[model samples]
Target: MTDTTGAGGPQDHESDGPTGPVIRDKRRIDPETGQVRDVSAEQVQETAAEQVAGGDNAFGGGVGDALPGGEQDPSGAPQATSGTPVDGGRSADDLHPDTVVAADRLEDLRRLQAEYVNYKRRVDRDRVRDREAGTTTVVEALLPVLDDLHMAKEHGELTEGPLLAIADKLETTLGRFGVERLGAVGETFDPAVHEALMHLPEADLPEGATETTIVQVMQPGFKVGDRVVRAARVAVADPA
Candidate 1:
């Protein structure tokens, strides 16, 4: 009989195996009645499994052992696609993707919220400042008018009629913006808020006066919020 062992087709012999190099003889000389080497399904399956596993069928070791590449991934992890399980079971991590931490996500959300809160506070502060500045400018321009109104009222020129009503409404409007008059007779006068044009004798000072006192307000001063629009022009009398 002619030796026709591997004549059937290609043989499954892994030249490289774990432990050492593997040599499979495909000769046609059977111990019983050797002619052509016969290939069995069981032998084929065993050989294929060994080759797929790579090293020891145990792990043959792949991230996805026997899955796909059956080789190591970029992270140095043995990678394998979905396939028959290797000799040993693979860890869950090897089968799935990475896990995301909820704490990290929450921290990021809180940080963004804090940043928005700070921005809102800053904007509110700027808005208040702008409003105060606008009020101060308007009050400064109306200082002379306010003085005329005060003088007229004291002289009984605005005791009644539309002029008195108009003055009252104007003053009321300015008051809403925190505008107020400065300087009054007998009030302690300070250089920061009072412009003194004349100084009377100490003898003319009001009773119990310890500091410079305003005896006459020639022109009333006005202010908006904490900003002085104009200083009070007045005559003063020093303490005895």
Candidate 2:
């Protein structure tokens, strides 16, 4: 039997035997019509080769097309020039412009804060030291007056007219500034406030106890605000 199928026709081998070769041409389908037509394999291969070459060309030119003085975009897409702004309406440098200035201002503020803290501490320390020095000076000046009172008492003249009055006034004035005297006669002997220059034996007093009187107060001591400027020099009783 003679084969009837053509090389490039549809349904040409339908009437032939089941084992006969059927040649179906490749064709682009019309999406709206669903119709078929004849096309050569060489033509399909050539069109595929052209698409591959075009893809390579597109890949190679992509960056150049996006830049200035490069190929114009064939698809009419918008392109950026060298001077164009970025997405946020700002240039590259504007994004980080304030960083240095902000850092400098922070350094300045830190320096100023440190200086202020040091100044406050210095002023407070100076004020405390000055108050302590003033207290020391006042205590030093009152020692001579106390010596005079002792001298007058030894001579049995401390109770006379203006001298007693002056002594009372001086004590009252010094008392206002936290001055206090120690080592009085007949008071109990305390080592914390008294310095024993000599001990005298007394038969009437209890053993190891201070006797009736302080025989002598060589120098009077004064305290200011709970701080002793000098220790009193006095003679204490001795148990026989």
Q: Which candidate gets the maximum TM-score versus the true structure?
A: 1
lDDT of 2 by residue, 1-240 (tens): 344345533443545533545455445786668876556788888777977777655546565665544534677554555445566875445556587689889999999999999999999988866775687698698688778887788788887899898988888887876778877766666677778787776424444554444656777777776578787888777544
Q: Candidate 2: lDDT of 103?
A: 85
Per-residue accuracy of model 1 over 1-240 as CA lDDT, tens digit each: 122233463333543322323687644477677576778888788777877766655564544655445566678766554552443676434443333356667889999999999999999999988999999988878877898998997688999999999999998999998888898999998888889998878437677889889998889888777778889999998776
Summed over model 2, clashes come to 1
Q: How do all models score by TM-score?
A: 0.55, 0.44
Q: What is the C-alpha lDDT of each candidate?
A: 0.77, 0.70
Q: Which 10 successive residues of model 1 have the least lDDT summed?
A: 1-10
